[model samples]
Target: MSLAVAGEEHEESGGRLKAIIFGGLDGILTSFAIIAGAHGANLGPVPMLALGISNVLADALSMGAGEFLSSRSYNSYVLKEREREMWELKNHPEGEIAEMVQLFVARGMSRVDAEVVIERMAKYEEFFVDIMMKEELSLPVPSEEDTLESLKDGIAMFLAFALFGMLPLACYILAGMLAPSLDVTSLFSVACVATAISLFALGAFKARFHDKRYLYAGVETVLLGGACAAVSYFVGRAVSQFAGFEQLEFVIQYEQQPTVL
Candidate 1:
């Protein structure tokens, strides 16, 4: 049989997977933290639902927009650097070649051999600049489609955050709308369960993009999320107790509710 590849297959799609994993993790933790805090402060499900939904929407938009801007800025910077490299290569060929020679020698190549390779590579200007970018700057070659890539990244992050992050709040909203008579402790317990499941599942999903085993990743994520949850609950309880605050009104007002929390 033909030899199997000795290395893992390259995946351009890994960027999207990265965004989803990170965004989902963020969503799950934030939503759960909010739930835990609300529970500690004795906030009702209706308010929890409102707060959770708001967090998801606002954070998702922020993530998407931030990703787009960051990606675009990176692309622009790379292009500028490449242009500078090209200019130097055109005007100051000796310095660029000398720099390349030094890099090769630093990496354990003989001076003569490094000079030979650089001479051959320098004959092709585009290839020459690409080598300099990689060796000298540790950068990938910039692409014309960078804008589209940014849009994709932003959309991926937004969707991942919005969809996965909504899990904890989703239970509260559903329970409030459909089973209004459910006690607060019972509802919070259900929310905790949902949050735990969401964190574990998202971790498992992340393992598909990495070398980590699914079960290990899942458990690690749960522990991390549990830590965050504990902190959030403690903060809420401390804030309420220190401020001498009473329990919020339990009414689920539909009309004329205050717009701000």
Candidate 2:
């Protein structure tokens, strides 16, 4: 591939990576909060695990669909802009040529030199097309391969959420299963600490893209996770209270449900 093609591919890769980071972090933090809150409110391990996994699935699917739509929207805008440029080049060749010459002059070329270059380039249709695309239009036509690659990127982003999001919730749930002796609150505390550290690390990594302070990103991520956990815990308590006697009976029935030998 030419340098231009290679550059465009690289940019698409960067965009996909960005999507993965944002979606993955969102899943991780959101699930962390829900699981932590459920645990804190003394919800049974089964219910807590079910809720966390369900949220992970729902959030991942939502993010993946959103990414696909956003990519399509961006591509549509670029295509429309390119079509507009093509029309301008077709209907007003002289005006487009003059615009190109002026652009070159603005970039430090002498007026006479810029005009001469434009004249020579206009003699070659391909050269003129390239100049208009690079300077006047500034819209690159993405190849078929690029479009497929972008879809792949969207899928990758979706999967990232699934993988990263399950980490904390899985840690807590599995810990409870493997060691029923340990209290859920204690298990949740461990999960929260682990989740906070992981999110802080991710936030720091994200700073490479946005040039934000590393400490601020780390603190923000950790705080967000904590806030989510707190809210979920209270919500679970409220739900349990509202459900009252029916909920207690349901919990008993759920617990008494026979396990297959």
Candidate 3:
């Protein structure tokens, strides 16, 4: 495989790109909110990192599983509709062909030409069913193994979420290890900068989906996502203040009292 998969396979694989971009976007925003909120809560590094890491894993799993189940449901619907089409072709050939003819004619195809076209198409049962599905039902006929394709999409979503979601947390881990003296506010600033850049780039990447200027898309993404994260931070701050949670400004040490259920 070429190292430039996105460039080389731009037209060939939209589904994978969609999973990667959207998943990455969701991951970044989600991680940013958790960190921002945790920071707002005045939690120590241990508690913040703990919250961020655990939430990332749990949410990533949910997103991945949700994507897989949705894809499976969609594939099941298409396959079931396909089987129904095949049955109609088998038992009600004339009616199905008539429907195809009407669709073609409604699109300004000459009646005689439409009849001739469908007549030839009807001779091939497989081709006939494919056309019927496309013209009559407006659904893509599944060509590959349905289960495998859905699984691939699901796995793509999972890996994307995990990889991208961990980015915000990675900043905290690296800073704690390398710059042990860095304060939480400064550390969070670094994370904010990194996340803003990532979100802008991802938004620009989305230019392929809609024919829009990359700058506009990038700004839109940053503004929208930043707004949401900001809300999370303020909410966390308000909740912490209202509840009078202890403020831990420690850099390394964390005190925890174990609870028994």
Candidate 4:
């Protein structure tokens, strides 16, 4: 079956769902990695805190800007195409109606049904305009309100990531100070607990949007978070051992090179 039936509009809902999934998962995953690395290398609170703060701030601003630009560009393109559609309608109303008829006919409507629908729609220029915009173009133009909402979604993603991402680092920092004698393994255990809880909750939140079962979602998120954390931890350990440096300066400094992505 098709994703949507006729007279159904799921674009907005689907868009919102995707935003939540990607934003929450990315935040949990990326932050988990950083915290795992910091803890693995036995870096002091200073570098760990710096990395957490930088990752959150930089990612949030970047995501917000990216959303604003993409939404604005898409909106502009839709509006331009709309104007083009309007021009075509004005220049050749008959042709536009015929095309709409063909579109309806191709969708299982009989010729008579298609013509009747077209005739009824033509009576209201606005209705015809909407048909062409929605059905033919398949481009949903965002209103000013929609543009603001899109930006807000991006900001929400950033904040969500920041909050979840910092949990592991925060737990490590707090635990390390309170128990200075705690070993690296102990610290990692605590951080993992924090990571698991945060990722599970975020995954559940994401699942709510999809109307899916939470158990699977939670497990998926937890695994992804753990994976990211493990990779960073191993990489950090290798760097520290090979370089014979107690600090993570090399890894962080090397990351400063222009990201190829």
Point to the candidate with the largest lDDT. 1
TM-score of each: 0.86, 0.71, 0.83, 0.79
Give all candidates' CA lDDT scores: 0.86, 0.78, 0.85, 0.77
Per-residue lDDT tens digits for candidate 1, residues 1-261, read 898878866866676887788888888888888888888877777787789889988999898889899989988888789999999999999999999999999999999999999999999999999889989998888677879988998999999999988888887667766887878887888888888888888888788778769999988999999999999999988887755533333343433486876
Instruction: Point out the higher-scoring one by TM-score: 2 or 3.
Output: 3
* Model 3 alpha-carbon drift over 4 Å, by segment: 1-10, 13-15, 208-212, 245-261
| Regions of candidate 4 where Cα sits further than 4 Å from its true position | 1-18, 40-42, 242-261
Q: Give the local distance difference test score of model 3.
A: 0.85
Which stretches of candidate 1 lie above 4 Å from their native place?
1-13, 245-261
lDDT of 2 at 181: 88
In model 4, the clashing pairs are none
Give the distance in Å from residue 184's predicted Cα in candidate 2 to where it truly belongs. Answer: 2.6
Give candidate 4's total backbone clashes: 0
Error at 37, model 1, angstroms: 1.3
Lowest lDDT 10-residue stretch of candidate 2: 4-13
lDDT of 3 by residue, 48-88 (tens): 88888888888888888888899888877988999999998
Give the range of the ten consecutive residues with the poorest summed lDDT in model 3: 245-254
